[model samples]
Structures are given as structure tokens and as C-alpha cells.
Target: MTNPAISICRVLLPALLLSACGANSVVISGSFPTPNIGKLPIDLAVVYDDNLLDFMYTEYSETGQEEYYIQSGQSHIQLFNAVLPAMFDNVTFVDNLEAAADSGADAIFVPNIEEFQLALPAKTRLDVYEVWIKYNMRLLTAEGAYLADWELTSYGKTPTETFLTTESAINDAAVVALRDLASTFALSFARVPEISDWLANR
Candidate 1:
């Protein structure tokens, strides 16, 4: 098949499988409550676990006697690193909380995952790995009072690729997860409609 044809197959095959599962096909779902917004205007301090990469793992697979591999969750820390500075200036995302407060933001928003899981489709006749990212956003006031909390969890599935390793699949899975998280946050926490518009464009 040509490149576009091959890509079309890759895209439609997943939809066919997911649709077959119907309600159980909820590979991604989560909620982010309205933020309190509090009484003061504040910039955001975003933080993540130092060992965020540790959440992922490698796996092996077999497809009709052919061996394959898969990769796990998205590198959210990397995404955070890339996205934060555009969200704030002069605020070290990986620094002491006190210092972040001194910089004069209304609240701190931490990016974290609660769970990630992967499962293979039994009928794909290929190895399947399921990946999930249990994520949440926490808001803290200057005095450290918990102002609001938003929980967002997402999951994705990938089978052993004809030509890719399980590790590579996992890495792809992570990207999907991060995109889901970004989409959720962009809709939920952005205070201004214009900021929300800007994120959607990106």
C-alpha cells in the first residue's frame, strides 16, 4: 500500500476495534472541576515528580512467530518542561515551593499521574499492551491552603507492531496520554476564553 493508504489503515483499524467494544471502549475519560479562582490574581507554578519517567516499562510480544516490543507512558515531565515557561516566566518549576510562592503567583498547579496501564486485544492475534495515566492537578494558595483539585485519568491500547518494538509502542502510548491530558487541561483550567482559544490552536 502507498504511504497514505497504510496510514489510513492504521487509523481506521483502531476505530473499528474500539467501536466494537462500545461502552467498554472507554479507553479515555476524566473530569476537571471548575477552579475556585480565589480572591487574587496569580501566576501558576507547575511541578511534577522528579522520577516521572519511572512510570513506564518495556514489554515483549509475538505476532505469528514474529517478535515485537512495546514502550510505555508519555514523558509528561518533558511535556511540562516544554509547556511551563510559556505559561510563566522566571519561575523554576523544579524548585522550592516557597521560592515559587515568593515570585507572586496566586496558586501552584502540579501535574501528576495516578495510574497508567496497558492491555492487548485478545483477538488481535498480536501482543497487546494497555497504558493509562492517572493524573491530577492540585492548586495551592500562597499560604499553602489547598484551593482546588482536578483529577484527570486517561488510558490507551497498542498491540505489537508488525515492525516496531514494544518499547516504541509504549513511547507512542505516552504521547497519546499527554495529548489527552493537554486537551483536558486546556479546556478545564484556562481562566480566560482567549487563553483557551490560544491553546486549542496550538
Candidate 2:
């Protein structure tokens, strides 16, 4: 006869181990709010530096195994596509500077990801993580002359008591941070005196 306690352990232990080994996948998305003011008059081209998209953060486990958390390239492109239309009446996404110039854009806006980091709690049971995203933006005329440069940083923290894995928590935090980033970009671009003056003069 099988001992009930032994049978229960035999069944439960494997399930617990499988749960611990499971990987989490999450999709990140954000919405851009409509601005009260009118859109900018100048047609602008948006370009992203592909080199910046190769960034990833690394984590080490207690057992000496390595883990990597990489940002989704599609997510970055989606954010720009979603937010730029709200800020400008005429916005075009261009793959290269030559394409931007050929498109007859007044100026080209280039955004680069400087840093993307994820931090997990010291203890695994905490089930929370923090994500940070930093971006550097440059505005240039169609003639390839620099107009202005700006830097933005955004961060977010995951829930402390959720049942999510560290990877899922990181994903959640990244979504929040990206949303904050888009909001900040819109506000800053609208309020910057240099940009305003350029628009007024143009």
C-alpha cells in the first residue's frame, strides 16, 4: 500500500519544480493622449538608430547561471509611431537621413536609447522589479545641421506582492516606464523655448 504522505509529495514536488522553471512572456504597449493645442506646422521625419536597439541587461543566479533581459525593438518603434502623430500634424518615419531629406521634411528627429536596465530584489520571494529607460534625442534640419538636443529618463516599479516572475515584473515595469517616457517627450517638445521659437520663426 502506498503511503498517502509519500504519494502527495511525489505528485506535488514535480509540479512545484516545473512552476519554478517556467518563463514569462509579456507584451508592452502604451497610448498617447491627444494634446489640447494645435500640432506643429513643420513636417518632421522620425528616425531611430538601430545600434541602440541591441542593448540588454544581464542577471546572475545563485547557481551561477546567467540570464538576459532584452528590450523589444518592435515596442520602441510602436511607441514612436503612436506618439508622433499626436504631437505633429505632418510626421513621417524614415529609415535613413537621405530618405528623410528626400521626403522634403523640414527637420529630422533622431531618438536613441542610451540605457535600459532592470533590477530585481535580493530575495526571489519579493516578486518585484524596477525598470529604467533613458533616451537621447536630436533634432536636425534637412541640411544636416543640428538644431537642438534633449535627454529623457523614465522609471517604474512592479507590484511587490504579485504572483509574477521576475521577468514578468520587469516587463510590467518596462511598460510603465515607456508610457511615462512618451508623455514626457510630448510635454518637453511642446514647452521647449528653442523649439517654440523655431516654430514661430519658421
Candidate 3:
């Protein structure tokens, strides 16, 4: 005779696996408001650390029930390219600082992803996931003189009753964080004292 507990497990295990498998890669997109910086055709070189492109995974819980991967390099690039025009009319991707200076760029922009994480559902709540992102940005003159530095962080929560819903919520949270970073950076860049000084000196 089949045990009742065993029968229930047989009926529920497949559903859990199916829900976990539904998690998929997220594609981020949005338009950012351009700050009111004066229109000067600044030539900027953008550089990204190679490690930023790597994907990292985190287990959902000690139960080993699920795992999720987070990757945001492509999304970051998309956001930067879309909004950078507001500050820099000419933007070039450079392999290194030397290349940036050699390319006749007025300023070099380096952005690094310090931390990217999506926490599993809260143990007590079981219905919310927390997403966090930390980014570091540096601006330098063509000759490598430091102009500005920024450390930005974004955190938010999403509802996640099921693995599929959890996945969707994570994606939504990531998009929100990315947009927040972009907008914040734009506003900060326009207000940076060094930027004003640089423009004045130019």
C-alpha cells in the first residue's frame, strides 16, 4: 500500500521542478531622462571590467530546492549607450586606459559592478525576494588625472509565491535597479564639480 506522505511527495515534486525550470534570462530596457547639462560635444571613452560579463549563481536555500543565475553586463552596456549621449556626444569603448587616451577622448569612464545579488524568498515570509546591486564608477582625464568617483547601490523587494513568479520578480527588480543607477549617474555627472571645472577649462 502506498504511504500517504509518499503519494503526496510524488504528486508535488514534479510541480516544484517544473516551476524551478521556468526561470529564464532577463533582458533589461528603458529610457532615461537627460539631464540639463549644456550641449557640448564631449568625447568619452567607456571601459568595463571583463569580470562584469561573467554570470554568478546563488542557491535558493539550504534545502537545495532551486538556483538562479544573475548576469547584467549586456544590460549595463545598453543603458549606458542609451543615456550617455546626454553628456557625451562621442562615446567609444576602449580596451584599456592607454587606448582611451590614445583615442583622443576628453574623459575616460570606468564602471565596475561591485556586487550583484538576488536573495531567495524570505524564510518567514516565503513571498518576497530581495535584489541588490552595487556599482563603482570613475571618471578621469585623458592623461589619467582623477576627475570624479561614484559608488552607487540599489536595493528592492519583489513578490515571489512560486519559482516562476520569483524569476519574474527578480528580473523586474534588476531592471528597476539598473535604471536607478543610470539615472542617478546621469544626474551626479551633471552636478559633479570636476565636470563643471573641466568644461570651463575646455
lDDT of prediction 1: 0.54
Give the range of the ten consecutive residues with the poorest summed lDDT in model 3.
23-32
Which scores better on lDDT, 1 or 2?
Answer: 2
Stretches of candidate 2 above 4 Å error? Answer: 1-37, 53-55, 60-65, 123-128
Expressed as tens digits, the lDDT of each residue in 1-202 for candidate 1 is 4699889999999999976643221212222232223212235665554445444333333434322222222346555555555444333563556766775665666666666555554435557655667776676665567766667777655566788754556556556666666555654566544434433554
Runs in model 1 deviating more than 4 A are: 1-42, 51-74, 86-92, 121-129, 158-160, 191-202
RMSD of 1: 14.6
Which run of 10 residues does model 2 get worst, by summed lDDT? 23-32
What lDDT is reached at residue 104 by model 1?
66
Candidate 2: clashing pairs of residues: none
Instruction: Give candidate 3 misplaced runs (Cα > 4 Å).
Output: 1-41, 55-60, 63-66, 124-128, 160-164
Instruction: Write the residue-wise lDDT of candidate 2 on 5-111 in tens digits.
Output: 99999999999997677544444544545444557777999877775544444555667555543555567778778888877879998888989888899899998
Better model by lDDT: candidate 1 vs candidate 3: 3
Q: Write the per-residue lDDT of candidate 3 for residues 21-121, one digit (tens) a residue.
A: 75454544444455556545688998766765553444455566445555667777777767777767888888888888898988998887888777666
